[model samples]
Target: MTAQEAEDFLRTYRSMLKTWTMAVAGFSNDDSDLLYRQLEADQNVLADIAISYPEKSYSVDLLINSRSRTWAGYAEQRLPRPQNRQS
Candidate 1:
């Protein structure tokens, strides 16, 4: 993938993560501020990763692995395989 595409995916994924974290916090009866904070931190980390690896092409295996964790399952279900083009 191109750097721009990677950046866009990273931005979108982090946004989704934040939204999910907020939903989790809002639904919890007990203090969920810590969870929200953690999510914020995670978002920062993801942003950093995207910046650091802007030109990296993400593989399907990596996506599947990510999907195996937390809410990645939903992301996995939603994301279609990238088309492989022959030059």
Candidate 2:
């Protein structure tokens, strides 16, 4: 993929991951498995793009890391009482 395409793909996948993570935070038990599968698929797509375009890998990695940190913070905030309060 071209640099522009890779950037666009990364942006799209990051947005999707954020959306899915929020969905899971709200009510995931009903379709947790499906959501997990979709998340994995999106991640795989990002990895493929990075591999196919080594020149754009740095930018892709930055995007992935930024999203991951955001997701981790959000997830931490949404965790249950005991989980969130643990030392």
Top TM-score model: 2
* Predicted candidate 1 versus true structure: per-residue lDDT over 52-79, tens digit per residue: 6744434322432442356433332455
Candidate 2 residue-wise lDDT at 9:
82
Check candidate 2 and list the clashing pairs. Answer: none
RMSD of 1: 15.1
TM-score of each: 0.34, 0.51
lDDT (tens digit, per residue) of candidate 2 on 1-87? 677777888777666666666565653334534655766666766788878988777866775674456344334457564645534
Which predicted model would earn the best lDDT? 2
- Clash number for candidate 2: 0
Cand. 1 Cα-lDDT = 0.48
List candidate 1 stretches off by more than 4 Å.
Answer: 27-87
